[model samples]
Target: MRNLFFLCAFLLLAVACKSPEARRPVQRSSGSFIKESAERNKKLYKKEEAIINKIIAQNSDKDFESNPNGFWYFYNVKDTLSTVMPKYGDVVTFTYDVKNLEGTTIVSEKEIGLQQYQVDQSNQELISGIREGLKVMKEGETVTFLFPSYKAFGYYGIEEKLGANVPIQSTITLRSIESSEEN
Candidate 1:
């Protein structure tokens, strides 16, 4: 009887010690949502490209790069924001407000103050597109980049809350408020 009791206790303890990874719920719903979103985003992206191309062809003021993978446009500002580009390992801080093209607030840090993060560290610290976008900027420079869903969150929106058919295009306006001196 004592041996049986010990075996049960050992089994309980072993199970308790298992890492969270072992307990993670199977992400069937999220996986399916992502697959559907990717399909929808592809069609929307093509439409966006056509619209952008039409706009560019009609206007001479805007300069941009066009390609199937993604598009980037740069506008020269009258005031020089900053020249400091944070290096790969450096920590950078900034304040930002994200909105739709019509200026509907989707996210903002103005009420919350500045946000800080270390560049290039993946996973929880930063989104892949934000990481990629920051690498191209310098301190004090403000840039607005429109990212397709693949560059933003791929097929899965952050937290799987954003709908599959919801467009993936996001206009990210970034200001490099500060960077570590070592950067």
Candidate 2:
């Protein structure tokens, strides 16, 4: 009888006590964090713009055209007669070479073989620069895209595959793009 009385009292006490987490309301302010993050990203974007501008000015051979996404590009070679271009979901095959600000080669099509990508068609997503640039070119055109890390490969720098990091601008040439449907 005494043991039962103690057990009942313990259970009652436990039930009366509130959880610590429940008692304290969360203090984090989502809006403040978001505002701060946006400011930081804006600064990063500006730095990238500066780097891209410098590269464009230094290269005399390439006449760059800017895009809203903060990259600049120029056609090294383009088909004057072909009007057909790659569209979304179209499979595109081309050769490319990836290089960094210092003109160091990151990867070359010669090292790998003809690269194949479906236009905005893959769950395996290509970088923003490549996808957007492809949309602008005809099958026989070759475009050189100059963009910052954010457009190429942000913070996570293609460590093993392509070694890229922010503040580092890269230039990639879409040597030749042919739609799979054409073949």
Candidate 3:
């Protein structure tokens, strides 16, 4: 009886291991999550662009140099010592003070101390604005950045150590970015 049972189980296993053509057809949806996410991001980006434009119109006197990545920057202290900007994978040390366009201080170098940032794709600590802004800054330069919400904080505002949401749809200014390169 045991031999007969083993023979039956062997037969079942043989039937199960069929050719690929015998397998059930895979039904892949025509719609994709990536396409949906991209569409949502585009709407958010457009909203941020409008908000930044209004802020720029309000402060017409300040020369805000805009970038393709949605951040506007201007040098407060243009030092010629380091004319070359740091590239990806370069280690840059800097002190930064970030504030909202309404002039509310979000965080400062005094509170967080100087930071050593590696210019790369995976560093979430640096916002899209700061990361892109760094590409234009040279060592010993103090640059002020005015970036849209999409570049600075996205839909969700930054959460501080004190657990306060800094709020969104607000343009942010990097009050000071004093960067120095390490040999």
lDDT of each: 0.56, 0.71, 0.65
Ten residues in a row with the worst lDDT in model 2? 167-176
Q: Summarize candidate 3's per-residue lDDT along 1-183 as a digit string, tens digits.
A: 999999999999999997667666588776788899889777766776676677778878777788876677667777667567766667677777677766567776587666677777345587777777777877777777777666666556656521222222222222333333542
Ranking of predictions according to lDDT:
2, 3, 1
Q: Which consecutive 10 residues in model 1 have the weakest lDDT in total?
A: 163-172
- Arrange candidates, best TM-score first: 2, 3, 1
Tens digit per residue, CA lDDT, model 2, 20-107 = 6555556866598889977987888888788778788889777789988667888877678977777766777766667776767777
* Highest lDDT scorer: 2
Residue 139, model 1: Cα distance from true site in angstroms? 0.7
Which should have the higher TM-score, number 2 or number 3?
2
TM value for model 1: 0.54
Whole-model lDDT, candidate 1?
Answer: 0.56
Write down the RMSD of all candidates, one decimal each: 9.8, 4.7, 5.7
Worst lDDT run of 10 residues, candidate 3, spans: 161-170
Q: Is candidate 1 or candidate 2 better by TM-score?
A: 2
RMSD of 3: 5.7
The positional error of residue 75 in candidate 2, measured at the CA in angstroms, is 1.3
Stretches of candidate 3 exceeding 4 Å from the true structure: 1-17, 20-28, 80-82, 121-124, 160-183
Model 3 per-residue lDDT at 144:
77
